[model samples]
Target chain A: MTAQQTLWSLKAGERCEIIGYDTTLAEAYRIRLMEFGFHPGERVTCLQAPAFGAPKVYQVSATVFSLDDDVAAYVQVRLEPRDA
Target chain B: MSKVILVGSPNSGKSMLFNRLTGLNQKVANFPGITVDVGTGRIQAMPERTLMDFPGTYSLQPISAEEKLAVGYFERALQDPEVDHVLCVIDATRLEKSLLFTLQVIRDCQRFGKPVTVLANMIDVLDNHGLELDVDGLAQTLQTPVVPLSGRSGKGVDELLASLRNPVMPDTNGAFANAPDALLRGEAHALSRRFGPGGELLVRGQARLDSFFLHSVTGGISFFLIMYLLFQSIFTWAAPVMDAVESSLGWMADALVPLLGNQVARDFTADALFGGVGAFLVFVPQIFVLTFIIGLLEDSGYMARAALICHKPLRLFGLTGKSFIPMLSGVACAIPAIYAARAIDSPRKRLLTYMAIPLMPCSARLPVYTLLIAAFIPAETALGGLIGWQGLAMFGIYFFGMFIGLLIAGLVSRTAEDRYTDLPFVLELPPYRMPGFKPLLRNAWNRSRHFVTKAGKVIFAVTMLIWILGYFPNYGADLGESWLGQVGHWVEPLFRPLGLDWRYGVAIFTSFAAREVFVGTLGTIFGIEGADENMVPLVDHIHASGLALGSGLALLVFFAISLQCVSTLAILAKESQSRSLTLKMFIGYFLLAYVAAVAVYQLTNALVA
Candidate 1:
C-alpha cells in the first residue's frame, strides 16, 4: 500500500481508507471530522469535485459531506487498489 | 408541562418528525441548520407534554454558533426539572455517522439521569432500496428503545408514540455509558457496521444525483437558471395577483367611501386606508411567491449544492458559500434572512451577511422600483419586444443593489477586526427528496401572514398618522399647508441634494417604518396633493407631477441601499445580540444611502444635460 495522501488529493471515484489525521490539523476540527465518521480505518469514496474545486463531496459511512479543501487536507487516507 | 427534547443531526428529518408528532408547521428543509430557532409544540396525542426541537448538529461538540446554541440548549434542558425525555433521531440509511451523534446524546442523557430513546428514522428510505436495519438488535446493543419510522410517510408514527409513552433511560451499565468519550466513536462505528444496512446502496443512489448536480458545467448552468427562475417568479407570477389585489382594494374603497356620512371619514377611507395600506397589500403576493420558490429549493436538498457552487466565488468576497441562501432570501425579506444567517458558521461572515441582507432590494422595494421605472424609464422593448427596456432597467437596479451589498461585505470582511478566528466550511448534502407541497404551501402561507401581521400594523399606523397629518387643517383643500407638509418642508433640505421636493421628502421620512410604506406614503401624499376628480394610478401621478429623471433615479438608489425597516433592525439587534452593532449599521447604511443617492442624482443630471 502507498503512503498516506490527503483526502483532497484523491480524484473523483477514488476509494480510500482513512489512516489518521495530520498533526497539523486544529484540535477542534480533527474531533469534528472524527465525529462525522471520518475515524481512522473507516473507508470513504470521493463522490464529486465541484466547479472551481475548493470544496469536494465525499461519502463515508453512508453520509455525504462537502468539505472545503482546507478542511479536507487534514484527513489522511490510503488509496484503495483499483479493481481490474 | 413535561418537555421532550428532539435532537438529531442536520437533515436527519428531525424537524419533519417534530412536525409529524406535534402537528406544528415549523420549517423543515433538506438543507442543514434551517431550525436556527427553537421550536416547541405539544405532542398531538398527549397535550400535557411539550416537544422542543433543537437545531441539528453533528455531535455534542459544536463547530458553529448555531450548533453551539443547540448543544447548549440540550445540555441545559437535561438539567431542567420539567424535562422528561430526549429523543435522539438517527437516519437509518446513514447509521454509522448518525450513531456517532446518537452515542454522544445517550452519554449525555445518562449523565443527567434523563430517559433517552433512539429513533431510527427514515427506515422507509431503507425499505424502498431493498435494505434493512435490525432495530431490535441495535436496541439491545445500545440498551435503549429503538423505534423505526419515516418522517415523510408517517409510517411507524404510532409505534413511536407508544414508545414515547414509557420512555426508558439508557441503562447505567450500558457499554456506551462507561466508554470514554474518545472510545465512543469506535463503538458507534462497530455497532453500526454490525446492525446497519448491509450494502452501500443509499450512497450509490445519492451519488448518481450528485454527479449531475455537482458537475462543473451543468451544475453552474442549472444554478443560474434556478436562481433566475426564483427571481423572475417573484415579479412575473405575482403580477396578476398583485393587479387583482389592487383592483379589489380600489373596488372596496369605491364601494365603501360613499357610505361614510362625514367628509373627513370619507377622505380618510379613500386616501389613507385604501390609498396607503391597500397599495402596500399589492406587493404581498410577491412575498408569497418568493417564499414558495425558496422553500422548493431548500426542501429539494439543492440549497446545500448551491452553497457548494457559490463557495469559491463567495470566498473571493470574504464570505462563505452558506451566505448564498440568506443573501438570496434577503431578496424576499430581511427578517427571515437575518434568522437564516445563523446557519453561517463564521461570526465575521455572518456579520457581513447581515450587512448585505438589507441591500438585496427586497419585495418591499418592488413597489417603489416599479412606480419609478414606469414614470422615468421608457417602456419601449428591444429584441422584438421580448425584452422590455423597463424590464432591463429593473434588472439593472436589482443587480446594482446586490452588487453594492457584495461590495460592502467584501470591504468590511477584509478589515483587521475580522482577520482572526474563522470557522471552517463544512456542510452536509442530504439525499434529495420530493419537496412536500403541503408543507411548502403552509410555510409560504405562514411567511406571508407573518409579513402582514408584523409589518402590517406598522404600515397601518403610519398610514393613519400621515393621513391625519396631511388631511387636516385644510381638509383636502391644500396639501402644501397641511401638518405633514410642514414636517416635509422641515426635512426638505436634507433631500435637496437628491433633487426631491417636500412631498417626496415626507414620503421618504414616513417610510422609515417599512420600505413598502414609501409607496403608501407617496400614494397618500399625491392623493392629497392632486385631489383629482378622477382616480389616477400612482405611477401616472409621478409622471404627471413631472418628477425629474435625476430625482426618480435617486429615489431608487436611496431605497436600494438604506436600512429602513424597523423590524429588520430589531431582528438584527436580537440575532447579533449586539444593540450597538445594530445602531452602527443603521446609521452607517443611511449615510451611505444619502451619499449614493446624491451621487446618482448628480450623475444622471449631468449625463442628461
Candidate 2:
C-alpha cells in the first residue's frame, strides 16, 4: 500500500500493525517516522483523525503523542479487524 | 583537599547523584556571566576530602548558551591551581553518545594533566534492557576507572566515593587518551554509521509510538486530558496537605499571639507575617506536585516529545517546539520556568518565550482563580459533558496565554527584523523507566528547598512590605480609610469600570509582589484573622460583596494575563542581558492585561444588562 493511502484509510481508534516500510520512499519516511517511534513490527492505535482532516493523536506504548497531518501521511499500517 | 567535579548531560540524574552524596549540604549559585546555577556540595569521602557537583551540560563544544558556560568553566579550570579530580557521569543506556563527551573530557585531561574517572549511572536501566557493557574494557580503553552505580538505589555509590577518595591517574599515553579528533568531527556521522542498524530499529520503534501520540487530532485531545488531570491532581490532592499546613500555621500564630501580648507585635505577627506570607505557604504542596510531574516528564524524556508535538502550533506564534517545555513549566512557577528557557537556543525565541511565560497561570495565581471561578462560574461541563466548563474555562485561560504569547512573538519578529536561528531539534527519547524514588524525592526536596530558600526570601520581604503598607495607617478604620487606602482609592477609579473596590485595588497592588498575596490581602482586608479559614467559597464571597458579574469576570481576565512576577522578569533580564527588553516585556504584558480586562468588563456588562 502507498504511504499516503495507508494513513488516509485508517479510522479513528483503529488498531494497526506496521509490517515493514516500502524502501522506495524509505529515507524521508524513516527520518520522519523515527521521531514518533514508528518502526517495523510495532503496533499503533490511532486516537484521533478529525473530520476536518487535521493532525492525529496516537498511542504507541505508554507515551501519548501528537503528529501533524503532513507527517502522518508517511506511515503504512496493516489495519486490524474490529472485535464484535 | 582534592575536589571531584561531577559532570554529565542535562537530565542525566547528575543532581540526584549529587544529593545522594551530600544530602542537604548543597549550595546552588549562578555561574558567572550566566543564569544557570552551579550547585556546589561538599561530599566527604574521607576525613580530608570533598567532592563538587558540576552543572550538567551536553557537550564541550557548546551549542546552547548554558552549555557554553560549562565550556568556559573547563577552559578557566585549566589555568586555575585549585582544581583536582574529574568524575564524568554517563547514562548507561545512552553510553555511546555520552561516551563521546566522556572521550572529550579524557582528551582534555590528557592534554592538561588532570585526574579523571567515569561513573556509569543508571546501570540498572541498562541491565533491565538486557544490555551489558564491558566496564573493564571501557576502563582500559579510556585509561580511566569505570564504576557502575545507580544514583537512585545508592548501590555502588560508596565504592565510587572510595575510588574518588583514592584517586587513580589516567595513562596519558593510552590509545583512548588522545583526543578522538576524527570521532569528534564526525560525531553524528559516527553515531548513525556505527550503531545504524540497531539505532535504526530503535528509531523505528520510537516512530511507531510517535505516530500514535503525535497525531494532530488525538494529540490535541490527549494534551488537554493530561493537562486536566494535572490541574485536578493539584486541586484535589494538594488540598488536604494545604489544610495541614494552614492548621499548623494557625496553631503557631495562636501560640505566639498570647506570648507577645503587645497589640502591634500581635498584629504584625498574625497579620503581616503569618497572614500575608503564611497564606501562600499552604500552596507549596500543589507546587511540589506540579514540579514532580514536570520533573518526571523531563527525566523520562517525554517532555521533549510533548514539545515536538506542540511545536507546529507554537511555531504559528513564531516559537519553536522547545518553547513549550518552559511555558508548560511556567504553570508551576515562573522563576524556574524562565530559567528553564535556557534550553531554547535562539535568543529571539528564548526572549519571546520568557516574555509570555508569566502569562501562564502559575500556582501563585491559582488561589485567585479558584476564588473568582468558584464565585462566578457555576460548575458546568462544556460540549455535552465531555469536559467540565470550569475545566474548559481553566483551559481557555491557558489557551489565551499561549495565544497572546504567539501574537506577541509574531509581532516582535515582524517589527524587530531579527532572524530566527533554528537549532537542530534533536532530543533523546530515553526508554520509559519508572522514575526512581531517591532521585524523585531528592529532586522534589531540592527544588522545594530552592523555592523555599531563594524565592522564599524575596516573597517573605515582599509579603511583609505589603502588610506594613496596608495595615498601619488604616489602623483602627477600614483599609479604604487609611493613607495606603487613600492611594488605593485614587487608583480605585481607574479599576472601577472593572468592578474592583479600593480593597481590591490594594490586593492587586500587593499581588504584584507575588500573585498568591492576593489571597492573603483579601483575607486581611475582610478581617479573617487566621490563614486556616481565610478563603470563603468564591460564590458566597462575591454574592455577599455585591460585585457585578461583569466586574468579577473582568478582574479574572486581568489576573489571567498580568505579569505579576518580579522574580520572573529579573531572571528574564539576567538571561537575555537586556534591561530594555525586560522593561518592554513588563510594559507590554501589563498594558495588554489592562486593555483586555477593560474590554471584557465593558463588553460583558453591556451585553448582560
Best by DockQ: 1
As for candidate 1, its clashing pairs are: none
Model 2: interface root-mean-square deviation in Å: 8.5
Model 2 bad stretches (over 4 Å): A1-84, B10-26, B92-95, B120-183, B186-228, B320-350, B362-402, B413-422, B474-476, B490-504, B514-554, B565-584, B598-609
- Please provide TM-scores, in order, for all candidate models, with all chains considered together: 0.86, 0.73
Per-model clash counts, in order, read: 0, 33
Q: What is the C-alpha lDDT profile of model 2 across A1-84, one tens digit per residue?
A: 553345435677687877655555445335435423455556666654544444455655323345554445556778877761
RMSD of each: 4.4, 7.8
Tens digits of per-residue lDDT, candidate 1, B336-427, equal 67766866767778888988999998877887787788888897988888999989999999999999999998898877484324777878
Model 2 chain B lowest lDDT segment of ten: B192-201
